[model samples]
Target: MSAANAPTQSQLEKDIELIKLIRSRGLVPLITAEERPDVPRLSDVQGDVIYGFPKASLNHALNIEWFFFFRIADSGSFKAGLSNPDFKPTSSEDVKNNLLKIGKARQEAKLSGEEVKRVKLQQYQIAFSKTGLLVLGIQDGIADARFDQRCMRDDRVFLGDQGKWDDLFDKPGYNEKDGSAHDVNNPRALHGVFVIAGDDDKECADITEKLKGIFKSSIEIPENGIVQGHVRPERHLEHFGFRDGISQPAIRNLEYPLPGQNQVDPGVIVTGYKGDPVGSKRPDWAKNGAMLVFRKLEQSVVAWDNYMLDHGQDYKDVPGGKAGVNPELSQEDGAKLLAARLVGRWPSGAPIALKETSLKDDPKMGEDPKRNNNFDYSVYDVPGVSAQTPSDYYCPFTAHVRKTAPRNLDPYVARQYLESGSIIRAGITYGPEVTQKERDDKKDSEEEKFKRGLLFVCYASHLDSGFVRQTTGYGNNDFFPITGLVPNNHGQDPIIGGPPAKGSSGEERDANLDAKPAKPFANGDQLDIKLKVPGDTLNRYQVTGHVEIQPLTQAVIDFPFFVTSRGGEYFFVPSIPTLKTWGTAN
Candidate 1:
């Protein structure tokens, strides 16, 4: 995909028209791609567009992030806050300049044999919801249909449907009839989110102090928005102990592309770029801006761990066990394996399709980008094994990774269309580490003592076909199709899946996994596989001697509520020029 800086004459005219429309609506002046300083070009690994917000940046330890929610109490005060040189919203020019300075600093530090303690400056980006635009006094007539349709709504994009709410073990806050913590009516409803990220807590705190003073009475800092720091030790891991953000699509304009990373068109993410993913006519003001989806997902770690302990042993008879490749593992080890299958990768970040034996041994493999994310479940050729099958035998079809991407399995009209579903995930795990004392206390509830979960943030041009489709169509659907596999309702995603309704009594919803019998081993031992379908109480097959007649073994497990939605909103991250205009507007 070509860079967004250059547009044809007709397109340029459209941009001009867009600017006029925005001005007519009294919108803050937005920076156009043409006016902004060129993003410093660098190698694929170092230089790129959309600085400071990508999966690679999360690998840096000591990283601290702050989420600020502000309500425009007085439009003039808010404008004054934006105009303040010290607390002015960061522009793309600011980001590029900062990156160049940081790069130079790193090089100087390395040459001078000096330790770089912390970045003196903090990096932040500003985005606003439809409510925020209104608060800023932009008329509703200026907003486009797509933005109005998505950003103006308060329902949870993934779980708001009545059917899905009924199916979940614990409904999201918005789903409840009574106003709750996450309800739209709650005071937590926010108009804008300002994200500040730094090298350490001190830097973040310093920036937060400055921002508080700058905005003062214009913004409301809710108690909930105070500060949710990222957890330690397992910095990148989610509360459930799985490495998050392992899978991300490679953007077209990047210089360096990692192995197995799918290259997506710029239009798929940035608005008005060539090959716009939405394929619908949009207002010119929408160009160059991207939609942001935010969700606060809280995890029940204690409940999740306990469920694994009770059911992990059941998977011992799974693929590895039947193939005789797996060692005789204790109950704890068995449970760990079961957890990995649900997550699609081990805690070490290694894909299960590559390593199935011991989760701890292949830490090196997981760290290597070339090998870590290179597996395709649809058609995989296992290393050192000659027999290649098109089935997702090694990796379950319902695995979190499989359900989200589906890779070649996507039935979209073309391959590029399939790649459009990709979104840049900028999520951070928020919560405290479980203490040994907390782990040992059998009677104590960990959920009560600790608040932990994921702050899911992603950028996409189209919410309906991108983030919404992945969460609702892929994450929620159980009967997601796979070629050559029989049509089976594989149940909800074990980790993030929600049931159609809360199960009767205390029993959780049942999720099915299709366990294909292992191919005849090279060692010449025929493994006997016995499949048990839960709720199969009638013994109908027992009388017919058809126990082994079923082509695939279906293992049904009780899946409980693992993750719950706290709150979220949709926002539009405008260009730097537009922000500047907003600040200086009369």
Candidate 2:
């Protein structure tokens, strides 16, 4: 065929590749099967695989998760369990099918004027930690050298070793004296983790029993290794009162795109995709696999709330304090503003970058899908308000969102280099709600003393640039993005950043705010701003400088750790076909 007249690959060929990819790798939420109108739906893709992502099932009210630490007593028995058709691993396809059936049932019930009975379907996924694979003598199956290296290393070193932990201004319980360390003995020795999520407690318990039956003879469940997590009754808020999972990056090559979401290349998440940024080619068997980083973080609700109560007034001294813009703010309201600044968002999940005034009282703004998660840090004015100068002056550079994502604030080279650092977070909060009475009582029952936090889970293509860099590089460092205006020895992330030195008491972290620039006014001088109209050819303003407004600067008191790491592990979620092969392997 002539080069100019050569035919393009048919839609059927593309569909086959897509199915093979989904089957080999897992499908996440928001992926659509039909990307192009010309493509005829394949039977495999149309049936059950075409449904919604399992982790994001809309009808799921409560989710229960269990992390199992098991040792393989007999490889043969383990393989037998893998071979059982009833115990086969749940694929994204299975989840989709279940959701479709449930949706249909609900619709039929609604049409018949009958109550839609809750479906008690249980969903489960299994992943092997590096230790689990080693225990099973399957280390050779891991083809990525980075995964292999990280898998072999302890998570303590990845997060913060004894030295790094000691350097923090406020020491976490896990890093405290041996007898007092939280999670000191629990998650560190785990071999593998099994996650079971369902609609309610009964479904979760049933699934747990089924899992026990599969590995009863081949593994040992550690006393404390099994942890449970559920969605809070308030919906998406975490223990610290911040809305989470709201700013996840959208994956490209999906069937559908979420409105206002920025889509990243598939290589940023899935292995073997063209967007994979690593220099080396992944192994054949490792194709379609993803690296999973798990962490059990406990949040001290009392301590966090206490810190805010004690230090809220100090926020006014910090740069970018809204008191400069809104002179009517009280000390209490200023404290609330400070709390919002530390979190990078208001309690309602509204990004501070979206408005000049604190949206702490405006819950509706934060709840509006069209407003939240919509602003970029590089812009100065609110959307549609172009008369103001463009800058990152409103939101502090070290704000949690800015530190993690940076968006246009990052240098072009660094931005491109860190593309692989993007990851998909699939975590749920664990712990009971502490009542106001409990806080005032100053005494916690034994059950209330039980640690509560997030079961942090994230999937990435590479550990080094993904989770590792995001933590050790960005989360730990104070002088990130390297903007010239940032002060020397600036403060680390207040919410998650560790202190500069260990064993220190009452230390403070530095933050620089890009306060609105001001010019000096002489006695009897009047100020006037020529507002730019919509169709003005040039949007420009000139302010005469008698004295410039210095950037707001302040130090935050370093308190005891609020979020402490309990345990974690690295695992590889492989293709179903690979699991089948392992099931039959000698």
Candidate achieving the largest lDDT: 1
lDDT by residue for model 2 over 396-506, one digit each (tens)? Answer: 766777667655534423455656567777787887887666598643323535557788888776777678777767766655655655443445566556432222353
Please give each candidate's TM-score. 0.72, 0.72
Model 1 per-residue lDDT tens digits across residues 1-586: 1366556778655544433321111011222334322221211111112443322232332366667766667788888887888865554445444443444455556679986434355666777776677677654322334445433223433343222211111223332122232232334446687877766778778878888888888887655565455645665567887766667775564323456666676567666665465435665555666778777666667767877888877774456463453566677877787888777788777877654423432677666666776766543345643333334556677778777866666442245656877786777777777666656863224353376777778877777667777776677766653443465566567656654232236454343438654553332132233446568865532111101112256555556656766556677776555566678883
Spell out the clash pairs found in candidate 2. Answer: 32-255, 167-501, 167-502, 319-552
For all candidates, the clash counts are: 12, 4
lDDT of 2 at 267: 59
User: Which ranges in model 1 have alpha carbons more than 4 Å from their true place?
Assistant: 1-62, 91-121, 140-147, 150-153, 157-188, 320-323, 355-361, 380-390, 410-414, 442-449, 481-487, 499-557
Q: Which ten residues in a row have the lowest lDDT in candidate 1?
A: 40-49
Which stretches in model 2 have alpha-carbon errors above 4 Å?
A: 1-60, 97-119, 141-146, 151-158, 161-189, 278-280, 317-327, 330-332, 356-361, 382-392, 410-414, 435-438, 441-449, 485-489, 499-560
Task: Report the Cα lDDT for residue 313, model 1.
Answer: 73
